[model samples]
Target: MHTLIASPFLDDHLLLRPGSTQGLRIGERRFKELAAANSPCPPWLVDAVGRRWPDLQLAGRRVDEVVLVRQASPFGYGRASYELNLGCNYDCEHCYLALKKFDGLPWPDRKRLLHVMRDAGVLWLQLTGGEPLIDKLFPDVYRLAYELGMMISVSSNGSRLPNRSILDLLTTLRPYRLTISVYGATAESYDSLTRRPGSFAKFQRGLLAAHEAGLPLNLNLIVTQHNAHEHDAMIDMADRLGLPHHVFSNMSPTIYGGAESLPAQSREYLRKRKPFTGCNAGHTFFHVDPHGQASICKVGRDPQIPLLAEGVDGLARLRSIADKLLLRQGGCTGCGLQGTCGTCMPLVTLYRKANAPLASYCQHGPDRRDQQRR
Candidate 1:
């Protein structure tokens, strides 16, 4: 049976059924109105949220199931997350990767990575980092990913998009999606968060170039104190560019890594919902550290659970480990939003280091009583 769930950020609903995952259609205007009127209960306004699903309902309340599930492997993608790199260039106020000490990936690790991805039967390989473009082997990495028959995607900051060489390379490789993080529509707001002047203009130029290059583009906006109010503007920019807008609710104080030495953000006094239940990490995706050890998403990086080694049975081994984690609660014990929450590994580790009792940042801390009461 398929189930429809509300996405934390997007206005449209995400249909999660047995062996399939898809996003339902809902226009921007309708999305905004529903989100605003719905307020705190993010899932409620969008409809299908909170509604129990049967084991076999199709379409209608169930919605469309475009993604096909592999019967032999079953999970969305046979192997969950295939982490490409860990380096990024931007110094945003809410950079979890940097804080977690997820330094960018190195070129020397290519052959090893190729072996891992191939053995895992990974359906989707997400190349992430401080900024994957910074990796000298960017082009080769894309080619290698494609050669392995893995659908490739990259998350970039767009600052380096001005490089024609990289743009040209992207044209041929044609990544499945190029998700660019746009801090703001204007120079002031954009540069303020990134702390890089003229970044906004660079991002705009990059958008145009990507479109010209025929690369699929998606815009991601991190909702922070400096730019949350500009949600409408961000949406407008996406509309103008004809791209999907991804708005992440800023929830952390600082990133992980020794950078714990850095300062924290002024958190918006919003109601923190109950931590989601269910072991989404292994059940959904597996986060890999640069050393080739697999953990439940990134949080496993902190606990240091080696689900798989960089060898023959790597993928299947990882799945078995994930299955173990899912069958029995590994870390997440009790809290709000248990089964319905998503977390970034770096942020969760950072919070855990700061407050040993609470390691998972996404599942950590107490909910704001006032916000919940309302």
Candidate 2:
């Protein structure tokens, strides 16, 4: 009797007897041959049957039934984001964390956490960071996840890919995707945003190197007032490289509840009209900080629950929170500007507590008010 195990990530089905590690990949013809006993049995198969079904030779003994079990996948939620580390090489001015200290989980604990996630049916993993590639354990962690049958995506700064060793490792692992942040199209504009002279050249070189290596790569254009003017050029650069790019203009306040680090124009940009629909954070997606603290998302990093301690049960608790959080509350519920409001409850709860001006995140800007006047 043979059991079949199927993998979503693999095209082949593995055929095995009960309690046997040795297996064969079989399609329709091989499966029928095995069932009908029409083909000669291989030595390995004979040995496996003998060892695993030793009791079957006894009188009145019958072959055990072959059981097939399909791999479990996450229910509705198929993706997860993990902040591999909080340490970064670049110190961008609009950084929400403001270059805070790196406090990632230890290597052993991180491995265990991945196991837990796999068991919970999370097959798609996003490994992000202050810059995931900068961490020394990145390669080992990535390999482990890949071996565990997870589709891995990386968020990086593109600074390290220029190195031959790193590029080779990336090419070998073949991550599902790599999203690199592009600050600017030129060295001066890019380095100025990163606050590291010559870093822009390193990024460009790394991007080109990755391209040459044939690794799947995408660009994330982080637009701040300082480099907003270079948006067109940045897109053109990605086009020239034949890579897809996404532009993000909204900037969050500092993680420490301060807006002091954001550029003036970035601060103003957040006040403009925006769609105010609630996010899908705790439901289909969640964020795990470097310290293994799980939250709804990066922007809504409050009420963090310890992920390793609670595991999937903690995710359930977060789902409850998300169910109750999908609406504008308090002053936002009845406000006439609700349609144009960009700020959500979580953002308001975090940033407004510091008494930072609400106007910075409100939709009642001068243009909106003037439109109302007319």
Candidate 3:
């Protein structure tokens, strides 16, 4: 039986299991409760409770109550998000990854990254890219992830897939998820977004191949101003293809390929399309640049603090660094959508720079007061 402790210092929504501690600091109320309460519940009961209520709304944000523990993983199963490739093959009019050039990691750095993930007790990883499959090094990286006992998940544009041999290798490697983005409903719409003439066919075949290979598939859809009207079509496509749609609006412009190519999203678009909760970038997850610089999230690149150094001590330093970096000092500071909107600090930086009002890149613009008066 695992004893669970509820912090009276914080709201009842947050709980701490005996072995599993809070990654972030608990509120004062939670701290007091934690101080007074000994282990009052077992792991089994806590797990049961989590199953009954998976998402706990705290501070107006939703987080998974139960963190799934990988039984065979001795390192305790850490979470990591790896930028596998930097180049995107598509040129969608509103493409995010396309704004940047694709840069593949050198073999040495790749190995070091794998070692770091292993040392940090990370068994699950999110492998993202402009288009991971576009790079030949992807298989090698995936192999390295498997060698290090990490369950890999690739977030791709569904543009390319591995051959049978590579697919077989991935099968043996056994990743946790392979998430692909489905951008449009029709070929015209898809190709228009991808900026490729025959890309829709290629992606369709890729999705089929992935499905045939028995890979667990998760589909992503960026609900944009241009595509929002076609939301039902996108959902139907996901359903027909037997994929779960993880839909969301645009991110901050800082994530755009470069500073020069930032796309603007309107505030109205944000209000209509975005979720109420803000982002979990620095709080729940951090971002690592190709140069090995780590920050709370990819939005704001603060060089003062990084998760790891060139070696082992780096891994041990991340959690503390993450703790210190809490409470971002940007767009979210006093924004109405602070907790609900998924905007990050970097996006805020770019947004403020582009428009003083901080109009969301994914939303519509607000009507000016002078115009209203006129």
Candidate 4:
């Protein structure tokens, strides 16, 4: 029997059998008793537990035989996201990674990296990209993660799933979730937003193929000024297909640090009305670039640490960076307009570098004292 370790970030202890995807969640006290027994457990479990609680000690000869290893920081992560590649067939106006060059790691390296992530206690692995399906090695990389007992989520534009081989792969692997981005409802509106003449048809074909194959799917309706009018239509399309859909209006700065959607109308429609304090990035979530640079989140301002070079040590650096970024700084600290401010510190820093005024992104304008009073 293998003992499972409890993560401090999590309330329950997850116990697993060797080479199994499923695990049993037990209480912390029970896990401690198991650990004290010094029973043999999977090396990855021991490594994960040790990271979560450094003060833990095990007794008995089995403990002496066990080899302890560390793969990630003490602050264990529950989910990890990898931008499998930066290449896409369609060009969407609201794509934040539009300017990033295609720089996916090779198949062999990607497989190795996945193993490292699995050992680091990442249960849910998200494979995303300009379009993950566009990457030739995505199938092999995905299969390896599945075999490693990691629940996988894929983000795609739904242009490639129509292919027979791709559909077959999905049916076989059966990923935990597949989220497709829907730009517009009609072919004309969709093509306009994607800037690709035939992408709309491709998306339809892909959606049909996925549905036929019984793949678990979700739709993300990206709301931009270009397609805002088609919002209801997009939902109708999802409804027709009997699929769930989510609307995402907020747009972030481009990967190149340019505010692509800073127009007053766009900002006004997408601005948040909350202080936006809660983020799980450095704590239980992280994003890895195609080249293995890890950061707090997809749009976080923390410096990207090279995951390959630093391995789990990179997570420690990420936590530090997150801590620094979370502190209210500059104009954001004690700002009454925070509740209505769309811009955060990271965004402000990006805008500052781009020489764009914060007011351009702020929905409440520069002087909101009257609004606050009201």
Best by the lDDT measure? 4
lDDT measured at residue 195 in model 3 versus the true structure, 0 to 100: 72
Q: Model 4 lDDT vs. the true structure?
A: 0.70
The better candidate by TM-score, 1 or 3, is 3
Ranking of models by lDDT: 4, 2, 3, 1
What Cα-based lDDT does every candidate model obtain? Answer: 0.55, 0.70, 0.56, 0.70
What would the per-residue lDDT of candidate 3 be over residues 134-196, giving only the tens digit for each residue?
667778888777655455677887767745665676566656678888777778777766678
> Can you tell me which runs of candidate 2 are displaced by over 4 Å?
1-70, 73-76, 264-274, 336-340, 353-359, 365-374
lDDT of 1 by residue, 318-364 (tens): 54555554432334444344454454334444555555334224433
Q: Residue-wise lDDT of candidate 4 within 60-119, one digit each (tens)?
A: 326414322212334578789999988888777777775746778988778778866776
What tens-digit string does per-residue lDDT give for candidate 2 at 1-374?
22322232223334543223344555555444444443345444445545655642322222223323235445345567888888899988877776657777889888888876666555568998888988888888887776665667889999999887778777776777888999888888888888899999889788889888888888998888877788889889889988999887777677667775545345433536467776677877777888888787776776788878887667777887765565677656656667667777777765665456666667575666676677
Candidate whose TM-score is highest: 4
Instruction: Estimate the TM-score for candidate 4.
Output: 0.78
Deviation (Å) of 292 in candidate 3: 3.2
Q: Candidate 3, TM-score vs. the true structure?
A: 0.67
